[model samples]
Structures are given as C-alpha cells and as structure tokens.
Target: MSVWLPTAPCTPRTCAGHTGPVRGRLPATALLLAGCSLVLAGVVCVPVVMLLGRAPRDRLIRWWAYGVVRAFGVRVRVTGRPQSPEGAAHTGTLVVANHVSWLDIPLVAAVLPGRMLAKSEIRRWPVVGPLAALGGTLFVERDRLRALPTTVRDIAGALRGGSRVVVFPEGSTWCGRGPGGRFRPAVFQAAIDTEAEVRPVRIAYRTARTDGQAAGAAAFVGDDPLAASLWRVVTAAGLTAEIGVLPPIPAGTLPGRRALARAAQTAVASDSANRSAESVHH
Candidate 1:
C-alpha cells in the first residue's frame, strides 16, 4: 500500500455538509468559470491554431490552461523540477506524471512546456477535446490494440521532432486516492522504442483539510460528475496544488517495458508514501 501527502491548500477536505453556503459556492463558481474558458478555448483558440501555426497553438493552449488554473482559484507550487534531455530543445522528450485529477493536464502544462498524449475519450469531452486538440494533443484509443504501433511511432516522431510529450502512466486519474495504484505500462512502449528519457512527475493536491486527503474525500472516478467535483474543489477554501518532478528515468539495464514502468511507478509511489507519512508526523 502507498500513502500520499499533499503540501498545498488544494488538498481535499470534506467539511461537514453543513459547512456554510459560501464555502460550497466558491468551488462551484470557480469551476463554472473555468469550464466557460474551456468552451471559449475550444471554439476560439483551436481554430486560431490553424491560422497561427503549431508554435502559436501550443503557446495559446498553455495560456488557456493558466487561465483555467486561475479561474479554479488554485495556485501551483513546483518542487524537484525535471531536466530536459541534453539538446532536447530541438528533440522530443517524454514527461511522465502520476495521475491525480482532471486538473493534472493544466497543471502539467503550466509547469512544463509539452503537448500531452491523452486518452481518445478526452477529446470527445464537451468543450475540452477541441481545446486539447488545439494544444497539439494526441489522443489514443486504448481498446484499439492494433493502432498502438502507430501511436508509438507517432510519439517517437514527436520526440524526434523535438517536441516534449507528456504521458500519465497510471492511464487515469487517482484523484484524492492514496498511491500504489497499478500503472498500466502501455505508455512506456513509446519511450522505450524511441529511446527517450522518461521524465517522471509526482503530483499531490494540498488543501486546508489535510495532505493529499482530497484524493479519497474529493469525488473522482466511478461515474462522479467531473464538472461537479471540480466545482466543489475550487469553491472550498485554501486549496493549492504541488507537482514534484523526479529525475529522468533513462533507459537503464531495466530489460523491458514492464521493468521501466515499475521503476517509474516505484519512484512515484515511494515519494507519495513518504510524503503521506511525513504529513501524519507533522
């Protein structure tokens, strides 16, 4: 089992349901504002990408994510920054982060310059998909195994093209949940085949309630309304998020994809557990 500790205000806290209307309304209103921005970004920013070209598209989408963070009333704190491969300014790099929330996308974007490879379903999400596409995001359909080789090739090409690509090894958000969640290992294929240095990131939401307590207390996974949960989170007071980038997990003697994924997962899970334990002691 792995434990998690978040060191920011965004960590989840479920105040008694009776905890005043003001607290509840804040997260809701903030989410509404952010959602509206996504709608606008999808409609306006995505089309602008075609006119402005890929570079501008990437920049604008990042700006859009920054706006979403602001609207959500969440501030981000980063520790243990990732190192881009030597000469990577002109090459592709792979960024791997442990999944935590829907906010993970914007959080990663805000911290590092990279386009993300997300599940194909995300692209179909109302308002979100278009904006993500504008950001040069690649969507993968996990169920379509036949298409995986192509996907891996695409990722390799992106890295070779000098674009930094982000991947979530957990394959889904573990928002407010403790660590040690099984890692899928599928995404590791791209890094291995491409010989890309995998940058690993650990994310934890720190809230006034408790360190990483938001994972279980906050609503994520299992048919919970994403928008609603987001709203609840933003309005809740004193929420902050922090992301820590571990050293790049280079292609080591670790023989295969499973080994690589495990290495990365272990690094992440250990960090999460340590943080959680430290929180308890504090």
Candidate 2:
C-alpha cells in the first residue's frame, strides 16, 4: 500500500503550561540553515576527496554526514556495531536499515561509512537533492522500469569497487510517533543480486524530555508542515534515536531477492521490537 502522509500545518501549537515559550522557525529558515551547512561542509571536504578519488572518498563523505547531522541538532545513539568479516570493514558491503524519520539519513550517515540509495525526486530538491548527489547518493525511480536496471548496476558496481551502500528497506519513513513497521523488500534486492553481505540496521525514536514526560514530539507526515515539525525537534531538549546493526547475512544463504528481503525485514522487525521492549523497561 502507498504510505499515508499527514497534511498538518507547521504552526507551533501552544502546549499549555509549558515552561519556556518556543517559537517555530520559518520553514525557509530551517531549509536555509540545513542547506548552508551542507554547502559549507562540501566546500571544504569535497576537494580533499576529489584529490584522493574513489578510495578515501567514502571516509570523507561519512565524516561530512556526521558533521551535517550534528549541525542540524540531531543526536544519534548507536547500538550493536555492524559485524564485518575479517578485512570486510574496508571493502564494499550493503547496509540495510529500517526508516524511522527524516532524521534517519543524517543519523545513519553520522556513524556508518557508506553511500545511500535515495528517491530520484531528491535530485531535484532545492538544496538537499543536489547535495546528496554530490555526496554519492544513488537516486532510484521506482516507476521507471528502465531506470531500475541502471540503478542496480551502479549500486552493484559501487559495492564491488569497495563502497558500502546504505539502503532503507522499508522504502518509506514510518509514522514518526511510534515504533518501526515492516520493510518493503525491494531495497534488499541489490544485496542479493550483487552477492553483497547484508547488514540489518534498525532505527528508533523516542520523545525528548528532561525530568519526565515528552518535552515535544515531532511527527512528519501527511500535511504536517515540515518546517514546524523540524522546529519542535530542534528546539526540544534532545531526541534519542537508537540504531542497531545486526550481524550480516551471508550472500548465498538466501535463495532470491524476495527471500533475502524477507529475512532482513524479519531480522530488523525482531530487533526493533526487542529494542522497544528494552527501552520501556528502562
């Protein structure tokens, strides 16, 4: 089914009796801020990466992602480390993760050294799309049958050339207010086709707080004004995002893409449930 998105206004709804008054930033401000940071970072790092070419470019890009996430006021809390086989850390591998929020991209990039497969529409976005492309993100157009072949081939080639690719198997962001849902299965096809090891990463988000109770919750969907939701998150004390990297599933173990995707979805779903349980108890 097509994911449902909310169409709420980005206005700052007054939360009765809140301590300090917080004003939502203008949508353009948020976008401008994020865009400026990305451009600034790129100006400095892109050159060095260019000099180093394909080899050290991955490391530079990952570092740049980390900086962008930090500058955007998003905090990433990582859990189980990605299990890389001996000498696998430096080679190309496929990193699969559950999608939780718009924040997931920067959060994942903050820690993992990899590229990402994004929707082709991102390429035309005001600032982010272009920046993403410059940073090695692969844009996929699901509707265009012809584009899939090239997308897969390019991704496979990147893996064989020793570049890790981060793909969101869920294909769409879950409702930001709750736990993660199931995966869509298509993202894992590249891992299966390329014979690349698949590493499952799960992302989780909880309300930000100080003493107790949610300081604020930011759920971006439907018509929820993107800028307003972002302001609530940015101004919140701190939001915690949990990232769990499960052990890699060997290439030949799964019979086909469907099987591989199902296995990964199951693994991520199981881990996410367990993680949620652990969070509730603590």
State candidate 2's TM-score: 0.73
List, residue by residue over 1-282, the lDDT tens digit for candidate 2: 232122222223432112433335664357448745684767555435656765466567666766665555555556665547666544468888766456677667666767888888888987666666776788888556567668778888887777789887665555533334555555556666667888877666554332423233433444456765665555543555566777788666988777887888777777343342221111
Task: Give candidate 1 misplaced runs (Cα > 4 Å).
Answer: 1-31, 49-63, 85-90, 122-131, 211-219, 272-282
Off by over 4 Å in 2: 1-40, 43-48, 53-59, 87-91, 126-131, 176-181, 208-218, 272-282
Q: Evaluate candidate 2 by giving its C-alpha RMSD to the native, one decimal.
A: 5.9
At residue 56, give the lDDT of candidate 2: 64
lDDT of 1: 0.64
Q: Pick the candidate with the highest lDDT.
A: 1
Clashes of each: 23, 8
